[model samples]
Target: MEKRKFLVVVDPSHERHLALERMLDIVTQRRESIANFHLLVGFEGADKADPNAPSEVIRGKQWFDELMAPVDATGVDYTVEFFWTANWRKSITDAAERFECDTIMLCESSAEHKRGITDSKWDLVRQARCDVVIVDEGTEAPIKTILAAVNTQAKDAGHQALNDRILERGKFLAEYFNADYHVVNAYTDSENFPDRQKISRMSGLPREKIYRDMGKPEDVIAATAERIGADMVIIGISPRTGLSAKFASHTTEKVMEKITVDVVALN
Candidate 1:
């Protein structure tokens, strides 16, 4: 298997390093598949502190070293960098592109403020070219079950491509962790319900493992995930523009609001 490069964004404000922990867990489980990890620790204060100052740089390095003690003990190859800019959302995507990372990992707290999703996080999700993993609070290693949310009713080429990507990534993760893989499709009413054989053929899972229900996408995904006791949910996010981007919320975001499990958003 080809190794994957990961860009992990670490927020300095949060006490819990959920992203780091999740990355470490992945590295531990699939060491050979990981090429290297780039750790980006953000300190959002360009006006207050001199980012280039020796004292500040030293402090940031010290904090990073302390936080990475466990990572170092694992003997995995990684590089650490600090960002002093307040525009961390752009910085994260920029770093990912610069490093040619396949995926970007962030903690749930970094995406939420006061129990609400932040615009900055949504911007990163929409702008990022690579996959994004939002590590939820209290997420542990060795994920037991992974639920892949798909829209089988999609007919457009773009939506079809996204469904294929979701299934492919979901299967990859399930194999990586040796976990149960399940696919879910939501319908508005009985007339639009997805076909079981089509879902099974698309997901390569038994019919019994495929979940189809009639409801809003978010509600069905949340309910199905809870019913199956999934540890992580993988969904696709299509980039929006203009009025839709401002007025509409992505289904992935709505699912994030409803579920406590980790989410992997594919573009």
Candidate 2:
């Protein structure tokens, strides 16, 4: 999805500004206009938090201001809200939905890792039903390459794929970081459902440059990610609704079980 209004959630920690800067840089390079922006700061509740948050909001307003100043040449309209949230992920998802944000950005924290223990950003991505763009500690180094892992088949009426979302995201990344893009779609023929694979590729990409993996999706993504030396693996996830919850394959979750590379998920 093209970024219009991005939601950035952070505390006033040392790591906060850098992550915000990195995400802003990515948004800038995309040339996608942002209509509204929310910068939510979360911390433990205390007397200090109650009052300090407001003072910090006024004092640190320039942190975002100065970051935007350098990119002012882009002329992208943006408005910021220095707000507070008790639950980081819930706060971000709610603000994004309320503001109709196109993407979400947040710095990785110790608490964030704890959330991921069950499933990190996937929980947010799945629940929000929107594209989530996260900035990790290493995100600022310049994302030089992206590995888009998909599952498709050769026998279907359609061809293979290199996702447009992945490509668009990758193109934005490539331009910003001077990186190259690689498309990877891996599938194994299941006798029970052969056509499902073909439909998977058509969701967001052009059907070409197909890559085959002969086993489960988890194995395929891991091996392919290793083979290509990917900086991040962008995959698709289907949210578990009323009854399909039993069968949904969370590529992000499965891939996370095996690899340490960064992951981005779209639904």
Candidate 3:
């Protein structure tokens, strides 16, 4: 297994204190296994010096020096940078691209817009070229179990080549964290609930553990996490929107909101 490269975007909020600590723990534990580590901090550029003079840009170097005071030595080849930009999400995406990061972790910032027509994080997640992990910050402890909310492959659609790709990704993370992997294929009918057999077969999970639940996607994920005692819920992010609302099957913002368990969302 190749060590995954990670890019962590830090925010200026105090609530993010726990999130940063938790992130530090995860990175520290997997230091040896990480190929590259990048921490990016971005602050909004001043009004471009009255709109035409151009914004005062922070220099490229040592931006993270102050924040990384606690952990002097970050695992893997590490780099910290500071950027002054109007768009946080754009900065994150640009930095991740420049570093060729495989995964980017998003920490909600203190300056997060409470009521807005646009969501910065949502724009970033949807536009990211690489896998993105959207976090609410300072969740809980080490994840004991991760529930991967997978959609059934439309085998009859003639596009079901191997199996659901989400299944494989879910299994991979479960194995990576040494957490119990639960695959729940939901259905409305009690009779069809036994379709757990199909989900188990596809996910290579124990069938008896899968159950049928009829409810909103958020409800199902939250309920399953509580019932299964899962520490993290792994959901997918595809085609993110400005609102980033929990529109259903798999999305980052929704999973994070509905579950008390730490959410490990994947893109």
Q: Which candidate should be chosen as best, given lDDT against the real structure?
A: 1
**CA lDDT scores, all candidates in order:** 0.82, 0.56, 0.60
Task: Write the residue-wise lDDT of candidate 2 on 154-261 in tens digits.
Answer: 333222332445545555544545665556655555453334345334433343333465677778777877776666667666434555543554545666556545
Which regions in candidate 3 have their CA more than 4 angstroms from the true location?
Answer: 13-15, 44-66, 73-76, 108-118, 153-163, 188-194, 238-253
What TM-score would you give candidate 1 relative to the actual structure? 0.90
Best-first order by TM-score:
1, 3, 2
Residue 169 displacement in candidate 2 (angstroms): 6.8
lDDT per residue as tens, model 1, 65-154: 789999999899998787777786878988998999999998776423744457777778777899898888635678889999998887
Clashes of each: 0, 1, 1
lDDT of 2: 0.56
Model 1 deviation from the true structure expressed as Cα RMSD, one decimal place:
3.2
Work out the TM-score per prediction. Answer: 0.90, 0.62, 0.76
